[model samples]
Target: MFKLFKHLAFCAAFLVAVSASAHSFKIGELEVIHPHARPTTPGIQNGVAWFGVKNAGASDDRVIGVESPIADHAEIHDMTMDNDVMRMFKVDGVPVPAGETVTLGQGNKLHVMLMGLKQPLKEGDAFDMTVHFEKAGSVPVQVWVEQPSAASGAMQHQEDQHDHSAH
Candidate 1:
């Protein structure tokens, strides 16, 4: 039954993304590859967040920004490597091609970041988040809070260096 529902949801999402209005695309769910939690260290209202999104539609979509009650601002962030130093900065927009899935994983590659969060987030908690696509309209996505675990065997590894061991 669970698998059935999962397939159904995916199918529905695919349908929505395909039937979007002109000049606009649609998304269904945005999933955090491996959600983790931590208490704010200091001088930070909330910690940054990351996740992946899949769009199975006929048109291109661009993830712009997001809005949530938990954060004062949400935006797309891209990671850069500078002479062995890693850096993170906001991207003007994230493009999602038709029938393709965009991954927002760790190593500060491409993901959503909730800046100026109103509250702290932890594992086992669920929060409502919205993803705004340039051509696609915003979609209400649920972010499931998770914990830091060595389960994936690549939690500490950089996003680009992760081997396809999970497969």
Candidate 2:
């Protein structure tokens, strides 16, 4: 039937689009998966990129740095609480244990800090970045910028608390 053929064509196109947007890269034995960022408001100088790094090798490695053309500098940062106050600081490196996965994102964990933004990151935008590892060297990745509503569940939950409509 014509309807059935049309439906199959639509599904095929959708699947290809999804797979194309899902970007990943590997450096030696390190696998970086689904690097993404949230859209930032105008004039916001900083944005964060989240991703997972899996080390499949027997030897441990470290994430030493990150570089992006969209910002002046990109660094590895960690959020911590001290005396009920939250603080963020640059970390020397993020350890990737042998055969283990390390996640970088918001909420008291390691994430890539993009400082001195050249421009606000908008939804549906894609950018290139390179992550440097201690043993694996540098691996280039494509980062997708998603709207706030499309952010990860953890980020969406944080945004929900700040929603003013409930007041």
Best by lDDT: 2
Q: Candidates' TM-scores?
A: 0.62, 0.75
For all candidates, the clash counts are 2, 0
Q: Write down the lDDT of every candidate, Cα atoms only.
A: 0.57, 0.79
**CA lDDT of 60 in candidate 1?**
71
Per-residue accuracy of model 2 over 1-167 as CA lDDT, tens digit each: 99999999999998897787676799888999889887889987788787889999999999888999999998876655556544567799988999998877634466777888899999999999998899989999999998533335775444323322211
- Tens digit of per-residue lDDT, candidate 1, span 1-167: 99999999999997786444112223453322322333344455544555555666677777778777777777666666666755566678877677666666533366556667676676667677776767656676666555433532253344334222222
Which stretches of model 1 miss by more than 4 angstroms? 1-43, 106-108, 149-167
Colliding residue pairs in candidate 1? 25-136, 62-134
**Which residue runs does candidate 2 get wrong by more than 4 Å?**
1-21, 106-108, 148-152, 155-167
